[model samples]
Target chain A: MMCGDEYRESLRRLKPEVYYLGEKIESVADHPAFIPHVNSVALTYDLARAPEFEELLTTKSHLTGEKINFFTHVHHSCHDLVRKVKSLRALGQQTGSCFARCVGHDALNAIYSVTYDLGKKNGTEYHQRLVNLLKEVQAKDLFLSGAMTDPKGDRSLSPSQQKDPDQHVHIVARKQDGIVVRGAKAHITGAVNAHGHLVMPTTSLKEADQDFAVCCYVPIDTPGVIHIFGRQTNDDRKCSGCLIDQGNPEYGIVGGEALIVFEDVFVPWEHVFMCGEYDFAFDLVERFATAHRQNYGGCKTGLADVLTGATYALAEVQGTVGASHVRDKLVEMVHLAETLYCCSIACSCQGYALPAGNFMADPLLANVTKLNVTRHVYELARLAQDIAGGMLATMPSESDWKNTSVGKYVDKYLKGVADVPAETRMRLLRLIEGMTCGTALVESMHGAGSPQAQKIMLMRRANWEHKKRLAQKLSGTGESRHD
Target chain B: MPGQKRRVSLKYCGSCNPLIDLSRIGQVLPAAISQETDLLFVSAEETNIDTIIILCGCPRACGNKETIRARALRCIVVAGESVDAVPVAEKDISTAIIKKLKPK
Candidate 1:
């Protein structure tokens, strides 16, 4: 358990190679642009320490009786999946943005189960190695950013066929002591501030992709690793003096993303969870995807709840709350938002225990939840924008309002229906603009794997043959269909 | 490269229509449109427009034929529908529609 301030202070000690706006970042914790996201992550630490949330946010380690942050704890039952979703929703409401810790949470659980099965079959010690690593993470209460996506230059070609082999993370060199990896992970959330990273392969691989099928952990400051911070919409506003333009000023749009470059980073044999285990890659990928997809149901719905509240408030301020059309629209938004929440719960309810004795969500339902999320979230955002009105897009910047000569004119004309000030309306509109139209939507669409990815999974997993057989049986075909 | 700027009024219908923001149009058009355009009305339409640039509301609505007709219309060098929302690999009926509506 750790306090928020302590967590923030801890990150300051590590010298991560971080670049932002084309220059190196020496202090990640204190930078204005990074501070909000850092603060969002720090809450995960703080919640674990709090007595009220202890059960939901912290779990006792099976290896050691020591209490560890729930993010690092492997799921022991369906209750754990439920608890994970509840914890994520609570954090989402608190931060109103991505905490950027769940990736590592899911990745660890994935490797935990897959490695256990792999070790049982191959007589390998990956499970024991992963448990040892988990114990360390629990003991130290460290933040682990899970890195998955690679640069993947050509979408049409496989990793082995790519013109630039380095485009996908792979084992560039191997030695008796350990293996060395060289490549970059793109859009890695909170990579710069994370204490360590758990790097996993992006997709299932073939024998040809053995070199690319690697999973390992490395400290953020591991030699030859560099992090370049990704730019977010209106991110420059974080450094600006005014808070009006910075929607959810306490927590920015999302946990800042970074390009994590691993250049010949060495991992000891003990730290390498999987090396050249191509078959186990899909297991790891599916487990991680299910857990992560379930997460979208919680976090995004929480954000949608906030956006709904904000939009409803905007309607009130504009004196449109009484309009039947507006009320219907708001109701529709709630319906869609709640449907997503139900999907999360549905997946959680359908979760089953892995061989490692931890519960994992059902893959089909999890992917369906994420796919529904892709469309409904956009609809929710559209409804919010509609309710907020055209003012959301046309609102003048805070600077315009702050200008001396025109400030009075802006104040006079931009004021809402009644008691609400012009500045307040403008700020609310800006907040809606930030969440509805910008990077937030992109995250909703692609964060847990885009809509098409989930559809592919759904199509494959669907029991179409059973349905066809049922129809044949009813049509006097001698019941030839098998379950 | 033609000096005569072709005026293509692009109006979007359905979900695609609402999503077409000025910034996206600004970002995507320069690479596709060599000639200057005028009065590109990117409005959300409940019904299809007769003009060349009628973006369908959803991918399902504009099947394979519609996509083909839009491509054929590319020859007009005057007005054309840029169906960016439709996935390129769709072999459904929209392709034929696109081909039939080719600019003569």
Candidate 2:
């Protein structure tokens, strides 16, 4: 597996067309705006090489029996599923932010199983093609951004009914050697830094929408591919060269998302995993969503651990740690965070094997895990803000703190305890603000899917009729339909 | 048996949330083991390693799996406050490990 420095150098070798703040970026690896996110990913590589982390971060490849990064391994058992969660939490604790690799990891697993099923049922060669591609991906330890969400022009209309055909990625041409696709994938995590993209359909489809059921690997620097980095709250702090204001600066707020436009991008026949297979689109979407959702409890809980620790420290610094209510709020935060962890562990423990011999987390429990995250993370943030007090919002800029004139007054007035420096208090508050504030908080609600998306999955997965039968059996009121 | 010391190697699970102090155990184990038994600690990469010591923070013993154990003739697992599935106190863990390495 590649080491952290090797991963950084690998990004330097790629020449992706990435634009940020209306300026075309010359090199993403060197840019301050992108460095922190890059560092977040780099740690994943570095940690795997450490002897202590090797057991969790690196695993032997089932395909080749060689040691490889866990991010690139396929799940073969429930053990693998549970380990995935544990590994994610470990990385989350290390980075204290989105590590930006799990999306691609989920994509790989979903595609692996889905393609195998498709090949067995349809007598196609897509599965072998994917295996060959995966061999290289594992060998090189390449970073791939899983690109799924499309820029749906109208939510009410399906892909074929959209006024603009390009709203969802579709096959624009079919040739003897390959196919050409066109559309844009929005809010793709780790887009600018990744070596390539594993693009998949966003939603299920019908016969008329067959053209949109396309999944292919596109290199980031491919001629027609263009990336525009998304803006985040307090993003300017990165470019401004201020240290303390940008809380958790080493790993920025959320995954460095980007809008990737595919202007008739061509893919070799060998690289295409699915095309005109509308029937399996739902399977791919559901599986990918399930795998991705299973991660929130692990990663977010790790972030919560950091956020909770910050709140406790701030409370102590302000001389309020002993208060009963303050202590209660801290306990409440732990309860909520651990509740999320329990959900993730439950789903992973309940996981079963798929038709292709790979395992997946229990769908209902995984969705429940993500659904709880949407509410609990916000509550965690609110409690953190409540404990932190108003200085989180009104604190002077780091520059103002550094100034020789008013700096003393700023320091003298903001002091909390007698022994602790005001600077310590300010730094702790900034860390909490970064974790609980704008972009980071919003990611919990919508990153994998919105709350409604999980609700939809729950509705489908729930055994309502069977549940009704159980209720009838208990009440002795109605005859059992069929036990 | 009187003059020669058995060579041993140590590996660790990347302590993300270790329940025990792995670093402290790692620091004192070499001298402790040498004093108690005719065992000399060596690098994990040594080809002639007689026994591999896998130090994990939890019972998960992630480093004690087949792939890791396949490195040497025999393996010893130190998970949290336990050695080889037997409970040991934090203060006596080093002595317990030393006991295991001593000849019968």
Best by TM-score: 2
Error of 1 at A433 (Å): 1.6
lDDT (CA) for every model shown? 0.78, 0.90
DockQ comparisons of all candidates to the true complex:
0.01, 0.54
lDDT of 1 at A347: 91
TM-score of chain A of each: 0.97, 0.99
TM-scores of all candidate predictions against the true structure: 0.80, 0.94
lDDT of 1 by residue, A240-273 (tens): 9778888778888877899999988998899998
Candidate 2 Cα errors over 4 Å, as ranges? A479-483, B14-16, B21-39, B45-51, B59-77, B81-104
lDDT tens readout by residue for model 2, A176-292: 999999999999999999989999999999999999999999999999999999999899999999989998889888789999999999999999999999999999999999999
Lowest lDDT 10-residue stretch of candidate 2 chain A: A474-483
Q: Candidate 1 lDDT, tens digit per residue, B1-104?
A: 24433333333221211112322443344334433242232222222323344443233332223532353223211112334442333222234233434345
